[model samples]
Target: MKNRSFALSTALVCALTLAGCGVLPGGSQKTTVDVWLMQGSVSGEFLERFTSEYEKEHPSVELEVTFQQWTGIGKKVMAALESDDAPEVIEVGNTQVARYAESDALRDLTLESVRDLGSEEWLPGLAEPGSINGSQYGIPWYAANRVVIYNKDLFAAAGITEPPKDRAEWLEISEKLDGNGRQGIYLSGQDWYTLAGFVWDEGGELAVERGGNWEGALHTEAALRGMAFYQELQSHGDGPKDADEVTPPQAEVFAKGDVGQIIAVPSAVPAIEKANPALKGKLGFFPVPGKTLEAPGAVFIGGSDLIVPEKADHRAAAVEVVTALASERWQTELALTMNYVPNKTTLAGVIEGNEGTAAMAAGAARGRATPNSPQWAAVEADNPIKPYMTAVLQGQDPARAARAASERITAALRP
Candidate 1:
């Protein structure tokens, strides 16, 4: 009798578990598409609205969106791909796109199916970074470029009349704006993005490719000159002494009316306005100053690119989403909502509705893409320029520091 009871109990438990499986009344489900994006100001409500609108047009598809912080996105993507659970669509930084493209993990969308939708309509220099070996592996959705952002009220209070038009004038203004518990300029001490701009402005190439060989150029005289110049500003109190106090949380320093000028990307404009609304009209922007007319100061171009993972189950659906994102209408909508510059040149007028967007777009037009090579990651991680910069800023000999930094960079690049 006990044996009979155990068998009955087992049958009952199996029945309960099967019943709890939970299926729709019709026993049918719509296909789900996965998308991964960075978690930030741009990913929240905007993505929800976009997905909702997209689903309405294609009733058979549902989107599952995952958000990750910018710092860990590359690792997350690689892990997802390795597990065969990769999202159909993913957002990658512009600087990182080349590395992924070379890995063969991204789908090549250069074929007629997607290209027929008008790939050439994108801005000339904007989408070039997403193209590798003549095949377009990704689409540029939004872009940001660095610009000279100044506190006009602080300048007026300091008795400065105009924005600097050249490198010498820029230094002069920085010196004049120093003292009185105010900084003449502010820059993140360890930010490669900001440092790259000054390097290019000094005629330094981050890297150069010859006959399929990549050489690190950061150890050159040009790069050292740029680093020394940056250090000089810090040593003279024209810039921040500690790199930690140069960015974001410390960005409030400007809002407190303690800094005269900074070079930052367009996304920071909204934050600046939010921190001090009264300074709205007081903020002004201009192209980064250069040493000569022929050598305009360089601005780093950083933004997101959309890629379809190789292991994704829904290639056709992914292609449709990519096409939609690259559409002029979609690009314009994204620009207006996110303050990102559209990749399409024809849609430039969409940003013209506001002065801030207009200025940002103009700056992005002349911006330069980071070097397109797999070795860039290593170069960026181990570069000695930052420490050398700190030494220069502390009043070390400029010429000597530049030479030393150059030698170190060269040694790092040796095969």
Candidate 2:
């Protein structure tokens, strides 16, 4: 009887050991979700902390995030999708989101999923680009718009009392501040985003839909007028002449107070403040002035977005990640950390904390999106507006340049 009892006890112990080693009927491990993000604007430390906190709350799920360069992320995502190994969640640029959505590469985020999410609780303009054919393909993470960043010290020295409020005044002010080893305005003539403002302000459409098809409108009379004004600024030495001399590659010029005013995005604000702390209180911001139009013009929506690929294995998990990122708390945190506009409506207070961000956000609220057609690449490539803009700035005829650019754009848009 003693031997039988000992053997029975040993058998029970063995069974318990096997169960601990996964021989049990209903024991499994937690699932993990993969997320991909761009590196520059988002901080790694913050992401790590956020991920850790999320995992603590969700014991069954683990999140793995990878960072990539801003320029090639789209291509990388496309390749990953082809291999059936795409990240469950991806952060993409606002401009690129349209192309992906148009290709049907993203999952359709129903209105129901986003309705109570309060994703639209932030600035309304930031949410505009994510809507394609009345469906949401991506959620805006953050956004930046154009603002006239001026050196107050320079403006005062030039005997200017206030920032210009209209196009005529802006041009007059530029002339007043020009010459004497200092430019009235410092702009990069080759920047498409910067140049695009003039076109939009002049009532030009970069691309327009007609007869159930998208067509290039970069060569319209409005565009010509816009391009002519841009050239005039460069010719008067109000800005830089070429792409290489633009703000990013050679910001030292602006830092040294060589340029009086510049149409700057919000991302450049931190750098300008950091580089010249003494000029902090002296810096000023306002909307980009219009040409013939009485009101301020539209500016490009510049920033990142969150997208889920159609080929992702964990579609539900990906949606959850996107929802979390698009949450009011997360969007506000991102705006405060990244200095860009938030997509959720409730986060406006965070951005409105500063006058500059507030003013820029207001301007962006009224801005228009870039063309959403897939052939945008071809249109941009064949467009001669950039070169013609250079010629116009160098004293070429506005009409001639406009005619030439219009012809090129028209040809490029032909199916």
Best candidate, TM-score: 2
Q: Candidate 2, residues 1-415: lDDT per residue as tens digits?
A: 0111112332343487665421323565445577777777677656866777777877766676767786766677677666677778888777677767766778888663467566546444556667788887877777788888888888888889987777788888888888899888777766667677778777787667788577556567888777767766655454555452454543455677767877777557677767877766777777777653556656776777788888888888788778877777777777777666777545557877777776677666656566665556566665565666666666677677666766676566565
Model 1 lDDT on a 0 to 1 scale? 0.69
TM-score of each candidate? 0.79, 0.82
lDDT of each: 0.69, 0.69
Worst 10 residues of 2 by lDDT: 1-10
lDDT of 1 by residue, 23-71 (tens): 2225444556777767763645667677778879987776667667778
User: Which stretches in model 2 have alpha-carbon errors above 4 Å?
Assistant: 1-29, 112-114, 119-126, 231-250, 269-282, 290-296, 344-346, 380-383, 410-415
**Any idea how many clashes model 1 has?**
0
Residue pairs in candidate 2 whose N, alpha carbon or C atoms collide under 3 angstroms: 121-344, 121-345, 121-346, 122-344, 122-345
| Clash pairs, model 1 backbone | none
